[model samples]
Target: MRIIVYGSLRREQGNSHWMTNGQWLGDHVIDGYELYSLGHYPGVIKGMGKVYCEVYRIDATMLAELDALRSKGGEYKRELTSTPYGSAWLYVYQHSMAGRKRIVSGDWLQRDKES
Candidate 1:
C-alpha cells in the first residue's frame, strides 16, 4: 500500500520513524486541501489550497502502525486519494480547525521552521 504524509511523518520530521520501513516515493503537491498547524504536528482537511507532502510505499504492518498513530476513525480518517503513484491513503483531519493557525503555504516543514 501507499500513503501520502504531509506533517511530522515526512522525511526527517518528528514521528518520521514510523515510516522507517517504507520506501520514499518522492514529494508531491496535492490540490484542494488545506494544511494547518496543530502545535507540534500538522493536519489537513478539504479546502481550496494545495498541500505539500511526501509519498511512501508501505506494507500492512506499517499501515497498521500509521493508523494507530493517526488515531484512525477518530481524530483523522484515512481515505484513498489520487497521487503520482496511483491511489494512496491520506489522513484527513476530523476535528475542528477553529482557531488553529492555517499553514497558508501548505508546506509543513516551512511552517515548522517558522514556528
Candidate 2:
C-alpha cells in the first residue's frame, strides 16, 4: 500500500522510524488542501493551497503499525485519497484548526524554521 505523509512521518522527521521498511517514493503535492501548524506536527484541512507530502510504499505490517501510531488518540483519521502517484492513505486531522496557524507554504519542512 502507498501512504502520503506530510508531517513528522516524512523522512528525517521524529516518527519516520516507523517507515524504515518502506520504499521512499519521493515528494508529491496534493491539491485542494492546506497544511496547518498543530504545535509539534502539522495538520491538513480542506482549503485552497497545495499540501506537500512524501509518498511511500509499505507492506501490511508497516501499514498496521502506521495505523496504530496515527489512530491512537483520534487526532488523525486515515482516508483513501488521490495523489499524483495514485490512491494512497492520508492522515487527515480530526480536531478543529480553530486557532492554529496555517502553513501558507503548504510544506511541513519549510514550516519548521518558522516554529
Candidate 3:
C-alpha cells in the first residue's frame, strides 16, 4: 500500500525509522489540505490549501504501526487521499486546532525556515 506523510515521518525527520521498510516513491503536493504545527510534529486537515508530502510504498505491518501511532489520543485518523503516485493513506487531524500554529507553506521543513 502507499502512504502520504507530511510531517516527522518524512525523510530525515523524527519517527522516520518507522519507514525503514518502506520504499520512498517521491515528493508530492497534495491539494485541499492545511498543515498545522503540533510541537514536535505536524498535522494536516482538509482545507483549501496545499501540502507538500512524501509518498512511500509500505507493507501492511508498517501501515498498522503507523495507524496506531497517529491514532493515539485520537489526534489523527487515516484517510484515503489522492496523490500523484496513487490513492494513499493520509493522517488527517482529528482534534481542534484552536491555538495550533498553521504552517502556511504546508511544508514542515519550510516551517522552520519561516520562523
Candidate 1 global CA lDDT score: 0.92
Better of 1 and 3 by lDDT: 1
Each model's lDDT: 0.92, 0.88, 0.92
Report RMSD for candidate 2: 1.5
Candidate number with the higher TM-score (2 or 3): 3
User: Residue by residue across 1-115, what tens digits does model 1's lDDT show?
Assistant: 8999999999888889988999998889999999999899999999999999999999999999888989855999999999989789999999999999999999998895655
Worst 10 residues of 2 by lDDT: 106-115
TM-score of each: 0.94, 0.91, 0.96
Model 3 scores a C-alpha lDDT of 0.92
What is the per-residue lDDT of model 2 for residues 49-115, given as tens digits with 9 covering 90 to 100? 9988999988999989988887889988888887667789998888899999999989998995665
RMSD of 1: 1.5
Clash counts for the predictions, in order: 0, 0, 0
lDDT for each residue of candidate 3 in 1-115, tens digit (9 for 90 to 100): 9999999999999888989899999999999999999999999988989999999999999999998898989989989988778889999999888999999999998988776
